[model samples]
Target: MIEVKDVWKKYKIYQDKPVSFKERFLYKRKGVFQEKWVLQGISLSIEKGKMIGLIGRNGSGKSTLLKMMTKILQPDKGELKIIGRVSSLLELGAGFHMDFTGRENIFMNASLFGLSRKEINSKLQEIIRFAELDTFIDNPVRTYSSGMFMRLAFSIAIHVEPDILLIDEILAVGDNAFQKKCISKIEEFKEKGKTIVFVSHDNGIMERLCDELYWIHESKLVKKGKPEEVIRDYLDFLSGSEEQRLKNEVMQQENQQTSQIEVTEQNEEVNKKENKRWGNGAVEITNIAIRNPDNENKFIFTREQRLEVELTYKTTNLKVERPVFGVGIFKMDGTNCYGTNTYIDKVELEISEHGKVRYCIESLNLVQGDYYVDVACHHEDGTPYDYITKAANFSVHSKENDQGIAFLPHKWFFEKGGES
Candidate 1:
């Protein structure tokens, strides 16, 4: 469990190089520097046994907040209260000594995490096996590759058996198989009710493992909610440059006199009347609608029912030819169920003049669950013309006797004597 209230961290950036030693000796002062608040007034509370994800663009203060929670760095203002022992993998070989052998660094990191000699001795063989460092464990850690060092570091950190685990992007260093092993170990800890604070750019993994998510932007906590909503927002942010978004937000804040917000109680009611674009692009998609054979837009459906997607788009370019339309269905973990492009099918369409194009997909076989649709338009040679990563997202509800991400509508019969 962790609680942060009104937390702020300020860092000093040197503005200019200090003068020569003679000037400094005479001036008796340090170089000129300006303070930049990396994190400002960030507050959040985490419940025990909950896995939380911290997400944002680079320099958005995610790592700063993690360090504050782990007590590696103290906040300039506010209080941070963390319950239970915390094991952190903030960086590769965080507490390791380059001069020390791998075995020595293991003992050092273990002791730093409060593991006794007897306890580390008990798990040493298992740790070695997990790290797969066999004979190389005796070599100096400076000689190890980045991946090997990360593997050993993670192996020791997790073996500490802390109540709280703090992880940054260190998982990126491990190979896929080792990362899988690490995820399984994290799942094991989650089953036992340990707290985890994970920070990553991999939205797929975050959505799969995080119980909740926090989105940090412009030195502040912007949104905290269910993994799906938070991840969606984060993805939208990714579609744009962070610097431009921050600048726009600041300008809007400064000129708040003309800004307006329309509030409505029911989301469905609001969506029925309002058209909201998710991002900026060369082509804009509008009028997205899907329906069944009965033309009903709402309610649950049988797995064997038909599905459709229709949308209209306006192009910004005049000279566009062989414009290919792409559609992708993605799972919650950002995994693609299937994706297709009109270009792949060699459907040639010439758009000599910029105008509107209407696209439709009929009788799509979708299983029972929530799924998102990413639509894009591109040239035949794979150059992006215009597109929305997620044009429309919809949910599929089950009536009964439905399974998997889609319903196959199949009938099976077994013969007793090897006859069909």
Candidate 2:
């Protein structure tokens, strides 16, 4: 179990760096600086056997709170208590010594976790095997790749079997297989009634693993409840409807001048063409378009309107069997709203030469915001044939004042009760 109350953290941001001792002395009194509070009166409690997930925007003090929980950082003013042994995986290669060999670092890290030499020896082989680093165990860790480093670090962390496990986003570094292995280990820990606090942007994984969710915004605790409810609220904030309105107002003012108007349009076109693209070239996506009910390609739509995504591609080979076509809708701030693939939907396609595929939605159901679409064609084995990031940009406007990315089909009902 872990408990925190009235936690506050603050840091000073320096405006300038002195280049020399003389400059430092001269500017000591005049240097500009500002105080930034990363956390303010934050309070939460995690029960002994429950898994909790943390969600927040980048730089919103999620990591700061995690560090405080792990005792790496002290709260400026608060009471904190933890009732168990703790293990933390905060950053990539955080606890390992760069100069030490992978073999040596395992022992060092385990020792820091409060294990004796005999205990380390008993679990040493299991850790190495889980990491799959037998070939490079004796090599200095500096020579290892990011995936190798994460594997070793994660392996050692779990083998220690602490009462509390705190994980950040470090799992993203490893490959798909290793990530699955790590998840399985976490599930095992949960069965053993260990407390886990995880921070991740992958909503699907969090919803599956966590018993509850905490939503943090701008260093304040926004909500704490079920995963679906908290995640929905977080996504709404990331959609940035108010922020986008301000931007549109600024653009309208600039459009009063013909010269400035043309420059803005040119920049928009450049941005559209600059979307990131990568693939093995087995198949290439030529174009992507968003269409409305009238089948007219457009970049904007209304909420609850019929929407379509069209993908145009070409296959290099004579016949490409079972090509997976996928689309992802993401808020401009990098929150994934929804994603789907033809394979997952039980649709099959075999393309030869050139082809066009379209996905139709009965109702867009998206709230008012700017969003980007990602399109990809890949093999069944997850090898990308052609993957495009932010391939198309679009905006959704709504007459209804909804608070989330999607509109659910629901109705409100009330019941009256009388004393018997």
Best by TM-score: 2
Candidates in order have lDDT scores of 0.76, 0.86
Candidate 1: C-alpha lDDT: 0.76
So what's the TM-score on candidate 2? Answer: 0.65
Model 1 lDDT, residue 96, Cα: 92
**Candidate 2, 47-69: lDDT as tens digits:** 99899999898888899999999
How does model 2 fare in lDDT? 0.86
- TM-scores across all candidates? 0.60, 0.65
Q: Give candidate 1's TM-score.
A: 0.60
Instruction: Pull out the clashing pairs in model 1.
Output: 367-405, 367-406
Which residue runs of candidate 2 sit more than 4 Å off their true CA positions?
17-23, 29-31, 241-392, 395-420
For model 2, name the residue pairs that clash. none
Residue 183, model 2: Cα distance from true site in angstroms: 0.9
